[model samples]
Target: WDLVCDSQSLTSVAKFVFMAGMMVGGILGGHLSDRFGRRFMLRWCYLQVAIVGTCAALAPTFLVYCSLRFLSGIAAMNLITNTIMLIAEWATHRFQAMGITLGMCTSGIAFMTLAGLAFAIRDWHILQLVVSVPHFVIFLTSSWLLESARWLIINNKPEEGLKELRKAAHRSGMKNARDTLTLEILQSTMKKELEAAQKKKPPCELLHMPNICKRISLLSFTRFANFMAYFGLNLNVQHLGNNVFLLQTLFGAVILLANCVVPWALKYMKHRASQMLLMFLLAICLLAIVLVLQEVQMLREVLATLGLGASSLANTLAFAHGNEVIPTIIRARAMRINATFANTAGALAPLMIILSVYSPPLPWIIYGVFPFISGFAFLLLPETRNKPLLDTIQDEKNERKDSREPKQEGPSMKVTQF
Candidate 1:
């Protein structure tokens, strides 16, 4: 593993392989979760990560390590995608954003924890083992996790869905859940959604609908920009400070803070606006980092930290907004499309970092430009704040139409003498 002067490029190649695995995972995992169930996919991913990630730590050669890391990346992506979807689907509308934010914040916590672990455990193998072992515990306890009722109902497993709901209700202290939450009641309440689910639309239908297609395109672009900037900054951290651990910890702290601020920020601002503002802030930070004189090392660190926080905020908002806006039936697929864009950026980020060695500001300039344009592009998308999750393509279309149609004055000025 002498990834030095001769094999420096191999480091980037390893990271690229890992991100490629994420891309593959998102594509396959989304389809599987949509066809199977969120809980099942989540459980499977947990076990995969526990086993494969551990093997990565014990890999005998660079090739073996990269291959295992690729597999680990797949499980990691599936775990994250399904975990966020499950949390969003199960939580009450009022808590949906918060729930998603909480799920994401764990990564921030892990980053901080890893900083400490890496500082104490200088052995890379031991550090990897330390991080990978916990997933085994998670996988063991994941058996109790309930499947998403929305997924079950939409997938035409109403009986199983109903059983899950009853269990949820009972756990929430509703003693009469068994009597009150019958299949008839559930079917009647979600009648339109049930009918829509039975239609069994292909994933290609997402591209066929103009409104959804546009939404997905814009979202994917934004995701690409965000990840490229975010990870580019992350990989460049070694250049910012002498103590990489300190910088890593500070980055993690800022990310955690940014995520914590999102639920509150969403309460006051529309999702589109919030994302736009964060992306713009991120652009400013990245561009400013390039402007700062190399002699003033402290200012560079400050700007980098701010950029990291801004990118983290925008990234979290992207996921939350994407879930809220996309219809339930196609949420996972749409998200995977966006995730593909994200992982592509992730794969390219290290390559971009390589550009820094040739001309230090070149990478930041490229990263800054993407988000700057994406910030303004966000204005085109609709706001999803406080809205009920749309369950079908028709529902999304109807909602868009309703938002566009002019509202008539109740009785005061309605077509007088028309």
Candidate 2:
């Protein structure tokens, strides 16, 4: 990268250009995904990522590299969010949360693999080529990707929706049921879906409800804290000690380990509670680093690793929780809104590290405060464990009402495993 730009300041800002693009992509790509189809948008996004990311590796000028990087960032963010949404829409309600959690875990593993590859290759251009290669894999596999049936049904393409549903039924080995399923039944279902969509207000109107307003504000803040802490700690790998590659490898390992444990935590706790716990733990780890004496450098390294683990866990929880809380109709848009804020904070994290030059503990203290205060934000969120995905504002209202209502005890009680 220095080959392209000799100015330290230009090079420094170049690091954030990708995230700035993500911020723009989250809004623009998100709206486009909602307006277009998920599979359609995903295919194009992956194609963009493959072409633009590869081109970025070969750019002659720093300006050209940054430009391609920005376009790649937009494609990357859209691919991630849309794919998650696509899977969530495809899976049954019983498995939706778990599917999202597993998807997040896979993402962590991919990052760790990338880090290991970078460590081995050591050439920036070669490493860039290696990383960009996976986008082509996504493009190849996208042919088998199904258009979201819910989106199809809601958008007045009931025949296409029913076809997808039938394919799903066949894959699930419900051949007998598939034979019995008729267009009339699907048409009736579509009618109800259309009526519900009509009854619901625009997604933007969700902010009007005081409870929802507060919840969005808090959740968005948590996302901000999640990214700030995540990128901040990752950026500080060199400051931890010598052997930058070793430190990064260890950081990736910590993240992979944390992702593995997140599913168990989600199983035992509400998503809201899990997020708060992870954030609080992250805060403790960061504060430990700040309070430790410089002479005890070893202890600070351990604290940093733990902090990275906590941040990774918090990120996974945030993604799963976000999918559950948002309605299907505008989920892509809502996720983009969250991503815009999160990536903005991420873009600022490197600058926070630069602040450490003036004061040794300044960056740690600033980063620590974000997640520490963010835990309280979860208090405003409702638990979505074992609940159906809310498709409309009315569904959310009814879900709250249902939760508030008392349960009647019966002779034969059934327990659910989330």
Give Cα-based local distance difference scores for all models. 0.87, 0.80
Displacement of the residue 407 alpha carbon in candidate 1, Å: 7.8
Q: Tens digit of lDDT per residue, candidate 2, span 1-418?
A: 5534335446546667877777778778766886899999999998898999889889999899989988987888888878888988898889876787777767657756766887799888988988887889979987977899889988878888888888878877886756667778877856866786666557667667665566667778999998888888876676775566666766877877887887787678788888888899999998788888877767878888888888898887787788788777656556666877898997888777656557978988889999999999888788888778788767877877988899987856866573
Q: Pick the candidate with the highest TM-score.
A: 1
Candidate 1 has a TM-score of 0.88
Quick one: best lDDT, which candidate? 1
lDDT minimum window of 10 residues, candidate 2: 3-12
